[model samples]
Target: MIINAFILFLSVALPGLLLTRMKSFSQKRIGYFLVFAGAYLFSMTVIHIIPDLFLSEEDPFKLGLYILIGFFLQKILENFSNGVEHGHVHSHGGYSIPYLLIALGLHSFLEGSIMTDSIHSNHRPDSVYSHGSSPKILLGIVMHKIPAALALMALLVAQLKNTKKAVLLLLVFALASPLGLFFSEFFGHSDVLPERYLVIFFAVVAGSFLQISTTIFIESDPHHKLNWKRFSISILGALAAVAAQIGF
Candidate 1:
């Protein structure tokens, strides 16, 4: 768990640090990358959400309820986040830094819950499979989280001039997934989340992912032209998301 968390942090923070060296802009190239990342989020939700839902073996009515609940709550978060979890950061409003961080943290916690549940899936005797959410989700989170973190950091820097506060803010962002992992594991054994509720909880997470993807694509300005480089990267991101879904 410690190693996994460390790797997660390093992957995001290091790349963010490196990228910080360059000027940040949401250019056509970035639009392509963002869109590709959004596609991956969508693909991952499709590839993984239904299987995890079915795995619970709960009633159809109950499952639907759970999915609906997830959809609604994620919608609420979007109202506040302007759909940051979807990879589109909103900056026009007042700097609700704490609120945004908390929302992002909640999203991270759901991600952690997915990790814990996927690894300990009681249906499979072999805990570690060639393709499972355990590793794949972790990898996917690592791949995209850095840019998300960097984007957050950049916004903070732009708003406030304190480097120390900005760095600490980044650290807090970095810790979210690990914190989620811890709480998810705690809840697993506490009987706080039954199979019926687990389905809903995870489904909500899927809804969140889907919500984020939609926000990214819709929020992107179409004034940017399509280019070969953008096309290729988008393909890679989409394929990677699919691969994670299929393989996991």
Candidate 2:
């Protein structure tokens, strides 16, 4: 768990730190990366996560409602984040940094909260999968986090106008996912979250993934036309998710 948390932290921290060494982050490149991450997130949620949710949850309708809640909840976060999770970080002169960090941090926290190892998933002996997500969900999170971190640092540097201060703010944002993993595990082991609530949490995060990924797909192609290159990248990303599931 310590190692897992540290890696999650680095997923946010290292990318932002790299921005300190570079003059600017490339939006064109980040857009392509977001497309790939979106494909992976959408694919993983459809295959691994949705199946796991159904397996652990008893009431399908109730679970579906929570998923909807998470879906709109992400939309609400975007109002504050200005689409930071989507890798489109823009600066408004009057924007509040606290609100931006809280919005983005909540989503990151939820992403980490889903990392308990088969906590409520009562799989058969022959079954090879667990609840929440496959271990390789870490890869998807890191993939998305890299660009988000880059965008976030870019915004912070512009807003604060001091690299040191921006990076310091980035450090606080970086702690979010690791803290989510830590607290969730700590509470789950201590029985603070009953088995049922654990499933609910997973369902919520799955919904958020659906929102984030689909928004990326839609916003990436505003003209509603297929770009063959992006289509190929999307296919590759889905393949990566499948490979993660089957142990490739």
**TM-score (C-alpha, index-matched) for candidate 1:** 0.80
Candidate 2 local lDDT, residue 98: 92
Residue 232 alpha-carbon offset, candidate 2, angstroms: 1.1
Model 1 scores worst on lDDT over the 10 consecutive residues at 122-131
Best by lDDT: 2
Query: 1-248, model 2: which lDDT tens digit per residue?
Result: 88778889998899999988987766788888999999998998888777777776459998899899889999999889888888886544456789999999999999888766645445443454553353678888888898889888988888899999998989999899988888777776775667788778878888999999999999888899999888899999999999888873
RMSD of each: 3.5, 1.8
What's the lDDT for candidate 2?
A: 0.83
The top-ranked prediction according to TM-score is 2
Model 1: residues with Cα > 4 Å off, grouped in runs: 23-26, 91-93, 118-120, 124-131, 189-193, 221-236, 245-248
Kindly provide the TM-score of model 2 when superposed on the true structure, using C-alpha atoms.
0.94
Model 1 per-residue lDDT at 242: 76
